[model samples]
Target: MNAELLARFHGVIPAGGVGTRLWPLSRAAAPKFLHDLTGSGSTLIRATYERLIPLAGGNIMVVTGRAHRTAVIAQLPEVSDLDLVLEPEPKDSAAAIGLAAAILYRRNPETIMGSFAADQVIRPVEVFQEAVLEAIHTAATGKIVTIGIRPTLPSTAFGYIRAGERLDISGAPTARDVVEFVEKPDGDTARRYLADGGYLWNAGMFVAPVSLMLKHLERSEPELYAGLTEIAAAWETPARDETMDRIWPNLPKTAIDYAVAEPAAAAGDVAVIPGVFDWDDVGDFAAIGRLNPASEETGVTVIGDVKRVYSDNATGVVVTDSKRVIALIGIHDVVVVDTPDALLVTTKEHAQSVKNTVDTLKKNGVMDVL
Candidate 1:
């Protein structure tokens, strides 16, 4: 990758989402991104920033919620106040990403910005950076590009991207034209897609020129573009807070896929670079078990102090935040999370349904735990 090309690239980290499925340990006050779920001694967001530093250098921005501003700052002290974008309320990815694009466009129209989620776990940072380099190269050719993960399995949890044909763009050998963006398919459809060999998991990672990004947003969603433009114009001024407070609430809420990528693909303005790297979103306790190394003796994964947790004939994940000793007996694939105010016990098979428990707690007005 050319140093000049890399210098023009800016990284955007969208660090939102409460991660309800990872409850007890992952709460509204402190989401999963703020926790060291992988036992790598670094929080997810911090790891994400470090992963991008080699490619993006100091040109990185973090978009998070207002409530997490202090914590985000505490975690990423290198992020300047100007680079930290705080949303008053959740308005989905379109607003978050579009606002970032709009603001960067005002500063430099030639900017090639890549948006990577703050919560995903990607390994072999060098491979990920190579794919990003190709995506950035492809994006420089006046097309919106996304780094699509090569599907390892027929996963219904993520959307699929259909690759059409290889592109002859310079410096991007694996670049392909995106045929279409498909929603999460049923089990049968997902299996068929896996067998098709032309599908990739839509990882929601986008790389595009700031100008082109805003152009598509303006065409697909004019109202959202207009509102974001207003806020971006005042972002570096004294009226930034007032402008965001007044206009942000009215911006439409939609993911970047629906608001930009899907429409851009339909218009034949989208391309994809297949990323052959290990990636996991860490969606639930099951994912936590997958990411962390299990104890060899007990066949269990433990976060925090391992000495405080004891298991006999158990195979699962245990997360402890309190001093209380946790003991498990004869349980297979169980998930035990012990927090100061809440405790969650479930099996790995039912980990995805943990979000339902959070919903029920909210419905019953169990606000303290959430």
Candidate 2:
């Protein structure tokens, strides 16, 4: 553990997503977090654990649906059964996080914490480590601190954080209050947001004292908060697991941002910072293309045996032999992903629409592959 950050803060990773957006590759049984494209030589969940090793010790927790328990355990052999907070069904991120908070608060009420979205990628260990340090420093106060990504584009697909003028802190170097939090905006509004220069891509990372989050969440979502509170109170008692088992199923599914930060921002206790490293959530297949260094024209191809296929492609393509042979004659900025059961041929512009196609497939009962 990094002695500087101390063992007071723990980490919570939400890995319960079904990843319907990346259907062909990320199905119900095999989720995207297990995908090897992130290149950490381990699954995304494992990589997430390793990433937080510097700040957390002996208290790392993973909250995931029971469906993925076997895979999560297989991927993280070092993590014990109790380290994972298994959900009976898929509750959205909010419930998952509350459950983690419940567990941690029961053990230690005064600890500070960090929450991570397992799918993201952070490069340059020094910069990423420094960002955590910065967040930790900001968290010393009662406010919730979020590491914001400096905008590279007016991305309509990502949420925006409107950071206000820098808030004066005694020791913290640079941190700004959240002026507003905006969900995914349209193309034009996104462009305006980028040009305006106060917005940041919400990185979905938070550094705050666990007590502060729980207090605020209790006020914002009272019933759910009561359930979590009861669970926290019973943690070491005989009814601890029983309380969680009963309450987790009834907890409302939400994101920490919606149930916690958005409300905290309204109360004027949120802060934002352009993180210290190049950051990415690595949300889908197209990201595989974007993650590679801009100087190198790297590509990812799948299942096709021909050396000549998928040439002239700027990004990558996944070719499954069962479908029409994806012979890319002269295509640029396209990711041709295929499984034996499903195929997706999309240009970069339409990459974000892949999830819509998956929704349509689900509606049509074509979930054989999805």
Best by lDDT: 1
Question: How high is the CA lDDT of each candidate model?
Answer: 0.94, 0.75
> Pairs clashing in candidate 1?
none
Tens digit of lDDT per residue, candidate 2, span 146-180?
Answer: 98888888887789999898877654667888977
Model 1: lDDT of residue 288: 90
- Summarize candidate 1's per-residue lDDT along 42-116 as a digit string, tens digits: 999999999999999999999999999999999999999889999999999999999999999999989999999
**Count of clashing residue pairs in every prediction:** 0, 1
TM agreement with the true structure for every prediction: 0.99, 0.88
Q: List the residue pairs that clash in candidate 2.
A: 94-254
- Model 2, residue 235: distance off in Å is 4.5
| Span of 10 residues, lowest total lDDT, candidate 1 | 304-313
Compute the lDDT of residue 353 as modeled in candidate 1. 97
Candidate 2, residue 350: CA error in Å?
1.8
Q: How accurate is candidate 2 locally (lDDT)?
A: 0.75
